[model samples]
Target: MPAPRPPTVPVLEVYSTFQGEGLRVGERQVFVRLARCDLRCAFCDTPESYPTPDNARVQRQPFGAKDEALPNPVALDVLLAAVERLDDPPGLHAAVSITGGEPLLHPHAVHALAVGARRLGLRVHVETGGHRPGAVAHVLEVVDEFSPDLKLASATGAPTPWDAHRETYHLLEGRRKALCVKAVVGAATPEAEVEAAAAFAVEHLPSAPLVLQPATPYGDGPAAPSASTLFRLHRAAGRAHPDVRVIPQVHRFLGLR
Candidate 1:
């Protein structure tokens, strides 16, 4: 019998841009934005990426050029070509970020992409919602960095999967320096939720940085957390984790996507 074909993933966009969040914030990287997400955060900026449209086209924006449209359900070779195209100067990118609506939804594709990025002498960074430890485990060996979000029910208006989040954190236990948990805090986010996320980080991945990102305004999302509220959350998180940092979405401030 012939070998089974690798999965073809629905890609939304691939571009060369600055890292927008977490520990690698402001660093230049190639972003592979995949399509589809299970959780629906109220403040989701890329709602367009959440659903796979029938006419969905992958936007390929290589460095120093306008974006070109490619067909969706792209093959791995095609995706790799897009990444290579964006990395024009060849090792200029700090990393190739595999982000998404939820990249882990296509674990095999993500793992393959990570492997390909490593071949090009680029670090592979996986950004995820951290709700699927199994999917994350599939790519752990190939990925150099993991940035998982600790979703809060109050902030996201979705069910919080504490167990899965914990499992994900524990998976990154030994990779502290290369891992970080980003918790989005809104003006209405509960203190308890922030504390729980911080406590988990302290217990499972103490050395890993815990970033409390003030939610950026999107759609009808709540207002950004006030200075006092952000400070309070920072202090609360700091109590549990010594390396807690309060950072907002820098890309939004700079008017970049």
Candidate 2:
């Protein structure tokens, strides 16, 4: 009998870029953006993730519209191949950043990829929305870094599961891995939320960095969050969590992958 095959995992897109956020910001990394999201935040940066074949709750939107569905799913093998083909391959000491659509939603698959990457000596990092701690824990063994977002005032009015996020951060606190808490900034990200998120980070992951990203202008909309808002948030949040820093979506600024 043939050996049982590993389950195939669906990936949205893969590209190479300077890690635009989190503790490992500006590092050359292979970004694997997976293809689904549970939450529908009004200001969701990658609205393209909402309507996978799995997102039955999703309503299809136009290509450049608010919530566009991805037609192709890159399997795990194909994804790995693409990473190896990057321009600065091998010499870059690739850091595999498994982001979302909510990477924790596919923890088993993400963990598998991380394990495989580590075998090749690549560091692994994960960026999640902090919805499921149980799922997050399963990948901790292979994940070298954790960058969980503490969602604040989601555009859809969904509440942040602070308890779950806090629990997961604590799990990574003293571990050998580096950890960071990120909050995506928007016009609606209240000052109170910034203070609270910063305070929570300081109380929980005291040594970990906190990242603030100003929402970028994507799709037909009024505008992205202003620079003033980003500065204000960085200052206030930094007051509580001294390591807090502002990082915009560099891909947008540079107009590249």
Candidate 3:
């Protein structure tokens, strides 16, 4: 029989950009943004990812010199190929960032994509909403780094899923692999919420670094929190977590997509 076809998932786009978030910020990475987010964060810049797309936009040449559209439910092979294309002179790129719509939702696809990335001598990073513990456990071994968002009601427009967050952290803690927690705070985000998120990180994954991402203005998303709010939130959260740092969406600053 011919070799089995690769698993497929709804891919939004595949492109290369500098790591724009916590921990590995500034590293060159090919981001595979999948479609279908579960949360409605008021400040989500990529609101387009909340729904499935008709096709996945792929960078067929370095620096996006050429682009192609692969029909939705794209195969794992195509994703790897896009990464390879963007890599240019080879090894110029770093890890393959497997991002939203909540990547953990498609655990099997995440594993397949991560494995393919490893074959190409690249690391695997999965960005999640930090609510799906079962899915996290399933793909934890394949993923090299976990960048999970701690969804706060004050920012994401949904009540905090404390139980799910705790359980997910319980699984990720103490692993040799990297872990970074992120909480998006808006201008009106209460200080108490930030403290709670920081304390939760300290209590569960004390070794994991936490990032306070100020919400950037997009549609219903609040504008960047005032400097006063940012300072107070960081100050309060920093008291509980040793590695807490405030990092806005750096890609925005660079005018990158």
Q: List all candidate RMSDs to the true structure.
A: 2.2, 6.1, 1.7
Candidate 1 per-residue lDDT, tens place, 1-257, comes to 99997568888888788898988888999888899998889978888888775433433554345567666788888888878877868887889999889999999999899999999888999989988999977888899988888888878988888899888888877655347888888999877778877887788777678899898888887678999999888888877788988878888877777
TM-scores for all candidates: the values are 0.92, 0.82, 0.95
Between candidates 1 and 3, which one is better according to lDDT? 3
How much is 190 displaced in model 1, in angstroms? 2.7
Looking at model 3, the pairs that clash are 43-221
- Angstrom error of the Cα, residue 56, model 1: value is 6.2
> Lowest summed-lDDT stretch of 10 residues in model 2?
55-64
| lDDT, model 1 | 0.83
N/CA/C clash count, model 3: 1
**Local accuracy of candidate 3 as per-residue lDDT tens digits, 67-121:** 7899998988878877887777788888999998788778889988898898888
Q: What lDDT score belongs to each candidate, Candidate 1 first?
A: 0.83, 0.70, 0.85
Give stretches of model 1 more than 4 Å off. Answer: 1-6, 54-64, 174-178
Worst 10 residues of 3 by lDDT: 58-67
The clash numbers for all candidates, in the given order, read 0, 0, 1
TM-score of model 3 vs. true structure: 0.95
Clashing pairs in 2: none
